[model samples]
Target: MRKTEKIFEVKDFPYPHVIVKDFLDESTLDLVIDALAGLEYDFKESDLFSYWASIELTDIDHPAINILRDDLGDEVWRKKVAKAFGSKSLSSIDMAAYVYGLGDFLLPHDDQVEERIIAYSLHLTPEITEEMGGSLQIFDVDNNNSKLIDSIIPEYNSLIMFEVSKHSWHQVGEILQDIQRLTVTGWYHG
Candidate 1:
């Protein structure tokens, strides 16, 4: 397991965000991926949106869930995130693992739920390319027009965090390949 000191922020976009590389060691990453592979996923799809599969991380006793929760909830880690994103103290973490295969997509929406301060995604997908179409698209909103400002490709052992606000409109692009786009994503609430 690698420590959390290497995390860094990226402020050159629609909103301030943090990107942490090498979030976990090779062995731990493999363990987490294996655990997720064994868990059953609920297919979430609708005309309004599409989510291929998801498994909530509500089982605190599960080893992979425990590891992620512990790291995200750690005081040091929280403080670093808070300072980097200019947010208040984060009080709670709610998360789930998502697997997006071919045709899976999520429409643009701001994650402005009450009490939620920050949103994060720990990318677990490997060998993803720009053409694969499972990118996190951040939008810039102006006069009811939302334009694409950035698109982040999901990379293995990388974490992306952003402030949750009305202008924080984003989407997960449709998957075009047979590969799975895996991510452990959720919000930090105040």
Candidate 2:
């Protein structure tokens, strides 16, 4: 179950972002992860990204996915997330599970799409290491020059969220080892 009193601390610099650790209780997270593992994913690739992703979670007919979608779409949860980012509304959300195996990566780009106010990634991997190389990289761009500023390891059960803007540049680093960087990600729309 989602925590009712969970506090969202929005941070400035490199664009507005927030990271909530252990967003889901241990048992609930484990169940969600197990449910995700049971779903089928299709390999998707392009110049910008490469990974295996499932269909939208909302459209899935599974118990865990339904629970996750319902919780994320809850009025209280939506309001809390929206208020944290100073957003007017999180009336809708789009979610999907992603699996990044060895050699998979996503190039840098801001998630600027129609009405997407907040972008989020919920990491579900049981374990990870620096050498595995599936880290989320945040970039800083000034005067048309881009520089890598931060590389965040995919810590288990952590949820990362950021406001989608022209400057919210980020990417998923290539997976170097035999590890699956699994995450449920999407956007909260206004």
Candidate 3:
């Protein structure tokens, strides 16, 4: 579906979030993917996660980067997204490219960080599958304890946006296949 035709509604299960399939048109997606392919990623690993990540896209001087920044920064688009998530304000955005290879994974955590009102991911892995893992897993939280609730398969051209709060606990499942699970993820800041 074209982005302009998409109706954003938050789903209650697992947490308040919105999934927009076919989020980008073919031409735009191709440009973005090509831009991402030119980026240099660093193999980042920590106690919580392991993946190859490119530096923030905002500082890059690519045409596709400019397109993304402008689109996400557009006042109307920002308002639409903020309203869907019931956020009062969305003043800025931060984005980076990520590649999760075999055995790569991220542990669960609520994306409760400075000024973050919403967290989002735009999946670019066209050949990824549930059996290959790298799914976005949402957790059910009760009394500070979290349990797996749902696993969203990363589909090409799909965009996932969710409210970022204490209850917004999620993680990236390990990648079982020897393939790259590509994504451009970031947050809308209040």
Candidate 4:
């Protein structure tokens, strides 16, 4: 079934967030999933079905949808993301993929890195039941000074957009089932 579009600009959200109307077309997402199914990464061991993923853009011929290579970084998404982050300009963008486990979870941390990064995650895993438990938890660094970022669940063919910099603390919740969570993690440049 096709995933219906949902309201991304919720008034309850503290941080500036915006979900792309058509971030990834179904064909593109499907292609990504197919590529992922045949990928091989011998990194560290994950407690759950989760796996740490990092692929170079050159590996894939699809410039429209790629990861890690500098060529796939489009200005359109960068500009939009920069505005959301309240930044003047965007220096670069990087793409990566995540395959989290059903019971895998990450600690609360910020995406504050070398550049002003606006992050966006596109879910590709189909039929994600609530039991999957791989939700992206974003904290509000302002209002809840102590803590409070929204925990957005991983819905099929959906996008969760946010600004990433030195202060954005976010994490992925654990999945409690035997399903694989796939996502396209985009990072913007300063």
Badly placed stretches (over 4 Å) of model 3 are none
- Tens-digit lDDT track of model 4 for 1-190: 1232333442325555665444455665566677766765444344433466758434566534453233225465455555555666887765667777655667666666666456667777788765577777777676447465566767776767666544567778777888878776766666
Worst 10 residues of 1 by lDDT: 1-10
Clashing pairs in 3: none
- 118: Cα error in model 2, Å: 0.1
lDDT of 3 by residue, 1-190 (tens): 1455454678977789888888777877888889899999999999999999999998888888788666655667678888787778798899999999999999999999989998899899987889999999999899877789889999998889998988899999999989999999999999
Q: Residue-wise lDDT of candidate 1 within 31-126, one digit each (tens)?
A: 788888877888888865677555568654678667767777667787778877878988778888888889999989998999989899989988
> How badly does each model clash, as a count of residue pairs?
0, 0, 0, 12
Query: Predictions ranked by TM-score, top down?
Result: 2, 3, 1, 4
How displaced is residue 3 in candidate 3, in Å? 3.7
Q: Indicate the worst ten consecutive residues by lDDT in candidate 4.
A: 1-10
Write candidate 2's Cα lDDT for 1-190 as tens digits: 7643474678877888888887787777777988998989999999999999998898877877877886666788888888898888888889999999999999999999999999999888877987899888998888799999889887998888889999999999999998889999999998
| Residue 59 CA displacement from its true place in model 3, Å | 0.9
Instruction: Give lDDT: candidate 3, residue 153.
Output: 97
CA RMSD (A), model 3: 1.5
